[model samples]
Target: MVQLWKLVLLCGLLAGTSASLLDIRGNDVLRRLISGLERGLDTFDSTIEIIFQNLKTELESRCSDEVVEQQETENFLEQLISRIFQVVSRLTGVRIRNVQVPDITFEATSENSANVSIPITADVTVSLPFLGEIVDLDLNVDLQTTVSIETDTDDPQVVVGECTNNPESISLTVLHSRFGLLNDVVDIGVNLARRVVSSVVEGELCPRFRELLESLDAECVEKLIGESQDTTQQEPEGRR
Candidate 1:
């Protein structure tokens, strides 16, 4: 009975040992599969991170370039206005004490280029002591007038001459005339204003005025102005 009991006990121990070894093998396979899945997930996460980082860097670079380009464009427009004023003053035989750019804007036609436009307003004050000397002139004559400025590249001389001759191109209000000669003073102011504004418009659109403008750091303005002047100069000189 004792020997039989010993054999049964031994068999039981062997069975338990075999079951434990199988369980260990199964656990090792499960661990290996889980590790492989984790490694794949880690690689995928790293790739996604790299892609996002690259996109972010590209966007920042593009935005920065755009900002710099916009700034340069604004500077160019400002210089253009300054050059126009300088050339105008030279042509009109007037002292432009101040030239101001009130507003400037641009419209983008493509990623690399834009069209810039500016609106200019000027205040002209003239001194007419000669008008005060005219004792017979009517002081109460209504002297308010309206003025318009036009820019043309073609046939600039004709356009400028027309503007100078047109009474409507310059508007003036006789605020006060010295020595009570309001009519003479008003006339002087009108003539001065017309001459100055017309000269400026002509200079801005004339090819001959490009050298003077380029000296003012307005290369872009000169280019556009030159194109217009060339077209106008090509027409028959007497056609206008």
Candidate 2:
């Protein structure tokens, strides 16, 4: 259950890595990075919905029990719900609608350091089941983070890496929902949310990003080798 919470938070904050910053030429790199982030978040939302349904079912079952027959079960359910609420309370939103990630700009600072900046806008609904109310919470957030890129010894052209985001310094703007403004209330848990998100980014997301970089690097190497072979094969024996 604790691990699940970490995953939930990771779905919110993202990560990555690379080599001495290569001059990023086209939108391809940014496109690929955002694609992974979007996919991770989409999966997160679906997984949460599934979990919510499962938990709701369990709660209903516990509540349906005969009072005297399952006193212990009732007690356990109460404690579980309380803990669950505490976890949910720290999140700013419960459901995400549209996510718009603007073009990302990346610059390599050194062989081991690279920085990326992007603006993300999203529409989300905040549901407080414990309070029996749901509210809209739109957001505009600025993301700035650094990644560590290491060159593979066997293949120096291939870079392996990981990223750590400065969540504590992330700029976030919460807009009023149609229902009302809840920033004051949500602000109370903003730091908590940031901390949880940071943990996931550093732990799970970073490793996954590293894997992605490695995979891309492998594909590039294969393509180059194939092209070289084709070029050699095309040469005439007379030239030799």
Candidate 3:
């Protein structure tokens, strides 16, 4: 009779242990982890704005008549950009200001991947060097980027799987303008250039985004994901 009681207690203990181990959902852990990561890299928009600021400065620099000679000729891309900046800057100075970041949200897309929505707004001022401040634009951009934990190698790290911008979500409203014709021209120019801009932003942002993730404590992410991994190991035992 004592042996029978002992068996009942053992089975109960085993069942309890299995429940405790399997109770944690991988998605739940991932959500919290991604939330933490988002907080850690809250300066994502600011970083993006900095890139644009650099672009503005570069444009202004290249716009000057006494052109700065190319220090690095290896990159043909830079040479092409310098020419574009010179023409645009000489015609009209583009100043980006009043930048704002949006509340980003995340959704678990896969075991180790998430989809994040980011919306940003900025004010763009276009000025003819001689005429001054010809047009002011309110720019709105909405984009989504896929972030994932890459663990194929020894060092598990966060990477940007993909970044996409909603074409319909991009708009440049002429808030105030001195020249209506120039404003229309600028609007058309922006519309035509939007895709190229998005492509450049995505290319520029991914590397910075990866760097932000790398800067954070990767071990914390590993621990959060590891807990789920450990819990899943109990499946065979539970079946028994």
Candidate 4:
């Protein structure tokens, strides 16, 4: 999942690399970057949905169809729900709507270090299609992460900081759930899902972003440096 979405960061650099640093306007670069990332995210959303659908179908097909009393029997029902949850968590449909990633904000904290923050908002739906949609719920994610840029070398490195789960740093809420017998279970899952998401951001997604951002940032910076050197050579010695 992380590797797939990392391409979104590359889109920003594609445009930035074509121009010199002095010629780059933050507003224009940011606008294009945001638009590019948004399109990448749309693709990300669709691709993941299809992947989940395929996984669910393939896995469920492998299960044995042994007859079990699954109706009102307490033991049977409990076992069934447990199996269902296992299936849902493993192959779940995730749809993200109203994805809002604020302009990448950064400030140079030192000669070769910068602080960067990214805040994202979105409506996410987690579901499993069973006779229609059995496990379904919409969640709101307000997430932010801080990173540092070490620019001492030709290659800029992105050091990811913690994405705190507090209300201020990151927050998730249950927007709604499909009305059904599983609503209570959905509620409990929401609480667990919130923590799971936070962990994913910290352990999985952030590292991927760091890798992608550093690779692209270095490439773009190298291009800009070359451009700057060319510009310097063109200048008269008195101007230096």
Candidate 5:
């Protein structure tokens, strides 16, 4: 009778062990998914950094000379404003004087969001009609924007769906413009330029970020899922 009881207990233990294997496998798969996501985000962040750095380099090369030369332009204030308006008409060649291209930095806020901060400093030369030499109008700009990440509702396999940027804080400053009669004019122009640049950057980044994230998602998921399946298949083979 005691041997019969022992046999029953052994079977119960074996059944309990078998039942828990599925739960263990599921937990492992979850771990792998999380790990894959973390790696994907890291790669995304690095790629964005490289892209921004390249942009900064390109802007410095392309616009720096044109801007610095604007200080030497005759009747710079009149010509610059006219140039700005003309460019706005065609939507091209809108340049700022003494231009310093901003360096962009991104920090991940969550699995699907990030914060971007860009700081900029430059000089806008305003040539008084009566004064031959220009006023070295300093510009300081601080731009902060938040990006949201979401999965595409229509495509479950397409992990990265949309990137939306929240309108953020923009601070513009013109240093030492207190003595001039054109102080208000310069301030207004500087603030306007800040807004234009901020909008352009936000618009460009959101779509690009969405595309990059989407590209990463499918491959990341595939690799992780494939590894999990391989591990599961090997487990039964090991037992055999």
Candidate 6:
């Protein structure tokens, strides 16, 4: 009986030892798996942070580039206005005292996936000095022009003498009285307006003013003046 009891106790001890070993092995495996999962989570967090930083940098760069480009465009437009004034003055045979660009606006709208429409509004002022005994009269005119740019085409079409927004054109009329001659300055004012409009359309300065001059009715005025002068000269000569 004693031997049988001892044998049973030995068997029980062996079974307990095997169960404890299995428990220790299972705990070690669980700890290793938890550590590996933590490491994986940290790596994922680092990757996400890197991606976010890169995205932020890219956005900043794009925004900065846009700002610089806008400033450059504004400068170029100011220069263009100055050049236009130079051309108009030469064409009109007048000395432009100053050229001012009061306002410049650029608006862009997306029409579709492929096309965008950009409208530019420029408010310009041209000052012309008094010429040929025209005293106490300063010729300063304000012109508001709006130009459209179609992004789909390579060459943009410019329409002059027609305001896209307003049917009525902005114009200045001048009347001059000199030396009892009673000459009208209607053609001069019209010529100046036409010259400015043409400059805007051509987008550059041209040496000759023939295009704008030919469009005016200056020849009719000259013919009437010439006939009057000839009649006056003949009458005075016959009397003498």
User: Whose lDDT is greatest here?
Assistant: 3
CA deviation > 4 Å runs, candidate 5: 1-102, 128-134, 148-170, 176-240
lDDT of 6 by residue, 120-192 (tens): 3332332223324321223333333322323355643322122222213333334332322212232333343
Query: How well is each residue in 102-177 modelled by candidate 4, as lDDT tens digits?
Result: 3334434443334445455555554432322323334443334444556677756645555445633456566665
TM-scores for every predicted model = 0.32, 0.38, 0.44, 0.38, 0.33, 0.30
Point out the higher-scoring one by TM-score: 4 or 6. 4
Provide the global lDDT of candidate 4 against the true structure.
0.41
Clashing pairs in 1: 145-171, 154-232
Q: Report the C-alpha lDDT of model 1 over 53-168, residue by residue, as the tens digit.
A: 44334323432324553332233333444454443333332334344544333233322223333344444444322222211111111111111122344422211112122335
lDDT leaderboard ranking: 3, 4, 5, 2, 1, 6
Judged by lDDT relative to the true structure, which candidate is superior, 1 or 2? Answer: 2
Runs in model 2 with CA error above 4 Å?
1-93, 108-119, 130-154, 177-184, 189-204, 218-240
- Candidate 6: clashing pairs of residues: none
Which 10 successive residues of model 1 have the least lDDT summed?
A: 138-147
Note the clash tally of each candidate: 2, 1, 0, 0, 0, 0
Predictions in order: lDDT: 0.36, 0.40, 0.47, 0.41, 0.41, 0.34
lDDT tens digits, residue span 1-240, model 5: 579989868766644443354234334433443343434322423443454444434423332324543333132222222332232212322234554433444444544454545454555433222232223445554445554444576544534434433334444445544325443344434444454444443444344434433444433434433444454556766574
**Candidate 3 lDDT by residue in tens digits, 1-240:** 569989868766754443333222222333433443344322333343444445444433432457666684232223323333233222223455555653334455556766655565667665433345556777777556665688898987766555565566677777876645333344533443343334334444444444433443445434434444455565698563
**Residue pairs with backbone atoms closer than 3 Å in model 4 (clashes):** none
- The TM-score leader among the candidates is 3
Query: For candidate 2, lDDT tens digit of each residue in 1-240?
Result: 579889756533321111111112112333433444445432434443344344445433432435644343323322322232233333323344455544433445553444544455555444332332333445454545544434556644545443546675444444543223333334423333344334434443454334433444433433433444455567798864
- The true-structure Cα RMSD of candidate 4 reads 25.5
